[model samples]
Target: MQNYFVGSDVGTTGTKSVVIDEGGNILGFSYIEYPLIMPRPGWAEHNPEDYWNAVADTIKHSIEQARIDPRDIRGVSISALAPACILVDKNLTPLQNSHIWMDRRGIKQAQWLRDNIGEARIHASSGNPIDPYYATVKLMWERDNRPELYREAYKIQTAADYPCMKLTGRAITDYSNASLFGAGYDIVNKKWDTALLEEIGLDPDKFPDSFPCDEIIGEVTRAAAQRTGLAPGTPVMAGTVDSVAAWIAGGATENGDMSLAMGTAGVMGVVHKEARFTKNMITIAHAVNSRDTYTTVSAISACGSVLRYFRDTFGQMEMLAAQSSGEEIYDLLIRLAQQAPAGCDGLITVPYFMGERTPVWDPIARAVVFGLSLSHSKSHLLRSFMEGACFALKHNYDLIQQSGIQMNWPLVLTEGGARSPFWRQMVCDMLGVPCVFMKDAKGAPFGNALVAGVGAGVFKDYSVAKQWTEIGASHQPQQENTALYRQLFRIYRNIYEDIKKNYQDLADVTGFH
Candidate 1:
């Protein structure tokens, strides 16, 4: 019998699962895409039941594909998109749709916290800036707007915690996810800040217990075993945030190394020995060393989503051709982009479709396409949109450097976007650095399985993570493309400044309800 470990990643667009052996080789993989709910502008949500179903289905699918006996699955771990607000009642039933990271409906609550408590204080205590993207602001929004739901919720959980609770009947959150709580978690002290919670009028018991990523949370319950096709005694490791899992998977476990996860959102993270609080980007406790070290994240809300939007909205012919020729639509788009010029003939797009994060932190920001001309084609549009995303990432990369975080060269690229040679080259040109690629960039799920292995004593420690990850190719920047991208990136910055106030004006004019 072959012993295996299972890992699940609850992401923004879907849930992905993988089965891996002690050697860190993936034997099976599966994904289930779900819909993102948009009841109104700047509001994104998903039913908590959907997450539970996705987790169960994907786990079963992975095990079936691996041709493994259920009893041979020794351990499991999960990674999830953080700052998601999942409130549940006494019976652990969801109160309503979860407020995911993409949602920005808590602007009023965020400003209130900033004005009342001061942004500097929040940053000092939480190692993060006060923004609608964090959990507390959304909790405040529910407390103020949906008071009934707020009063009835017994415990507020993160996305990763929810699945763990279902599997183990234990309500607990990992340090990485707890760091995003609005009431503030002391990164250095490794506990929830009681004073901050009291100041915000939040009950401490309402939050779940926090633990380190590799610590075993509990054994899989019989109910969960029946639902997920796993053994009842299988150990469940306390997992981590999705980007941190990507970091571990990319072999950026030590200081000075960096990792980039370009999934639905673009996340750039660097591992550090000490916690550095900055108002510019998010700072969270690292999964590997939650007690002493930290991970700083610069997140862009919609990088891959912008590309998906173009494919769904404008690539009908390409989609049809791909179906007939047995080629992927993304491959067709990449080919089309290759035919276009590097700068897309002066076409520019600012991908703020769901506001902006990281340096700008503007929830009102909107997407814009400049320099459109009659000569432009679909290929140009696609390439320009990709360039726009690169520019956004460059902004965050520069901010990370400006914040005094030292990084080793050749940043590791892990996730779906890393598979595209054209996209990797664009990132190289925009950031003016070499990008290291990995052979199995299956991302968070793979990393989660590795963590499960460690927790189950299948591996010695996280230090063995480097042995599991292998580098594939290195993409060096073209000096000419870098110079050109620098100029375009400058214009990109200026364009945002020039049109910054117009976003609010448009919102006001449209009666932004």
Candidate 2:
């Protein structure tokens, strides 16, 4: 007689699925990673078929691992990377690969919008800035370059909506995801800005209708049930973006609550009761209260991706050591980083390998390692790399504060990077804030399951997520480390200001842009 729910996160790099009981305890979990298609420089894409297959596979695997009957599942929900434009035909077949959030090929389109439509007008309407990161610019790029594909498309779908359509045969988006569409979704009014869309020369009909994040959109069809191993009639909720889901799972429900999700991208979400839209951050409707609350977010283009890049590009010796010894290469790298002292002996890195987002919004920005000396070892470089990411985060936080947003103390950190105590402590020192993380953090899938539970009436409300989340560890800022980091952070900020113009020059000379 116990009820269970299924939740899945269709991420940029992969999909994660989990089965949890009514109590929010994860009983089953599975993750499947797919390749990020990079056809050209600054372009990122994904095959829609890969998303559907991964969603189905992960759901089946998680259900099987949970040892539970699919019929007992009350509901299902999904979280996904947002603002991805996937064009589908009448038969729900993708016309082409999706242009994901990381794709920066729409720079010209974004610039056109700023010139013609006006950046302030667009930002005022959508609560998002004019950037290639938005779906509107990407769609413009598609319409301009791939006119045939654009003409043949029936509807535009996001990474989350595509999977939900496959599950329930309904092409719909949630408010949170819809706000980031940037094609004229009015975040404050909670409606499509028809005038804005028309001014931008986009067909408003191409976008789907949006619902509340927890609204039960539809039930799984027989074909979807066969594919996902769920009950044919199991209800599915319209879910939010992956970072928002991770924020919910980290127990951030009330106004002023803050969370940091350290996935491939570092996303920081701050929940507020009023719609305080700032150009410094991306604004979206809160998954918990779609109407009254807003979650403003700042994103770093690369966080864990930078670490992975280092491991793949520079950690050959550590990788070989791991092959010889039964150990994780990440652990070995972290061990090496631990050998270095605070501030990494005057070495600093600006982690802009994939350009940058939030506050800076620089598309041509590249990574920089400054103050490198012969005395600096690989360990020092490794540690400095980590500190660099933290510095970028602090940069965003400082800007957010300057914009008159009050941040709640003891920020909650979640996802992969938060799993490391050393990294967590580094964040504490860098941000100069006490931080706590959830014990046995379940990531976005857990929050998706909670959304399903709410929609299915298995739980009273989302506040239960906090009751279910148990704090694992807490770290206070080390006064000495915080002081040193404050000094280094200033230089980190100055380095970007000094060389930001050079990034574009380098790109123009090399034709990388």
Candidate 3:
């Protein structure tokens, strides 16, 4: 019998399951979506049970769709949302509602941490700044605000590890998730740094045992088998964060291959042959393996969702059509944007709809639409949206490159955002490099499977796994647009520079939290 592998990705809105033959062709895949709960403003969460169901549904559907026997599945892998703090008791049941990656309840704690830890010191120690988006501040907030809840919490795992724990009946973390919260997980040493743990005042023991991303921690248990419909005792590799998993799928190397994930927010990551960092950006172990490093980070909130917002709130016609026709509203937006030329004819947009994250760590930042003219139409507005998001990435790309890390390759692109040829070309034009779009742009699921393949001895390492698994299409940068975009990018940078004070003042006035 031939060996089959399964890669399960737990994304923000859904869990996706993909089955791959030994040579890396996707046999079949399935996506099971669950509704998101925004209980309060700036808070994002999921009922842990919802996530588990999503995982099980997607897996069973993928296996059945592939028409493959479960016994052929020799290995499994997982990639998950990062910086999500889910507390589970010793019995592996959730302690409380999980505070997802988008939760902002730790803002004040994050602010206090920035002052107490000092930005440069924290960066030097953890390769990350003190920020609310990280897991530590979330954990700190729980410990301080919900003391009894914290005491009752048995383990704190990332979004990816939690489901895997349920599958394997064990608790463990991969390098990618452990390092995100600035909890002193070291990329270079491949171990948790005790000194940094002391500095952050976290219990080292509370952290799940760290494993190399490709290491086989255990297998599917009878319980997980019944739930997910997989063979009991099938080997499941410890997984990495979604972005880390993506870097592998897209072939981001340490020298500087960059993968920009545009989902609810935008995340950019580059693998470094050597560990590296700059102010505001983070450097951590790659999700696939410890031997390599990745400077994982992002910005441009409401990135992909920004277009959805425009269509939903503004383009109500398209939104309704999208719902009825089973086509993305962005597809219509992209076609319209393509009708307009480069530069969107003097429209400047800042995709700060939900405030900025990476490159500029300003939580107080507000979304802006500038340089709009009377002649501008929906096409111009649509084009500017894509351009604006690209500019945000360019801003960070410039910052990440400054760390003096050489890119392994020019560009690596993968994500749901790649569904549009227009978006893919726009990124290439903006970044002035060829972005190889993985034809199978399933993002994290493909990445996690590659990790699992390595762990189960199907592949040798992250690089080798990527070499065979990734089949991609390339988009070379357009020189003319690059020149035009350079000027627009200058203005884009100036907007942030010109509006810093106003952002702070806005934060003061609109304490909406």
lDDT per model vs. reference: 0.85, 0.88, 0.77
Q: What total of clashing residue pairs does each candidate reach?
A: 0, 0, 8
User: For candidate 3, which ten residues in a row score worst on lDDT?
Assistant: 462-471
Tens digits of per-residue lDDT for model 3 on 15-133? 98898887778887988888788988778888787778888888888888888999888788888876888888888888877777778888888877767767767677677877788
Q: Choose 1 or 2, whichever is better by TM-score.
A: 2
lDDT of 3: 0.77
Give the CA lDDT, 0 to 100, for residue 406 in model 3. Answer: 71
Model 2: residue 229 alpha-carbon error in angstroms: 2.4
lDDT of 2 by residue, 359-411 (tens): 79998888999999999999998898889889999988887777676689889
lDDT of 2: 0.88
Looking at model 3, the pairs that clash are 254-271, 254-272, 254-273, 255-406, 255-407, 255-408, 256-407, 256-408
Please report the TM-score between candidate 1 and the true structure. 0.92
Better structure of 1 and 3 per TM-score: 1
lDDT of 3 at 286: 78
Report model 2's TM-score to 2 decimal places. 0.95
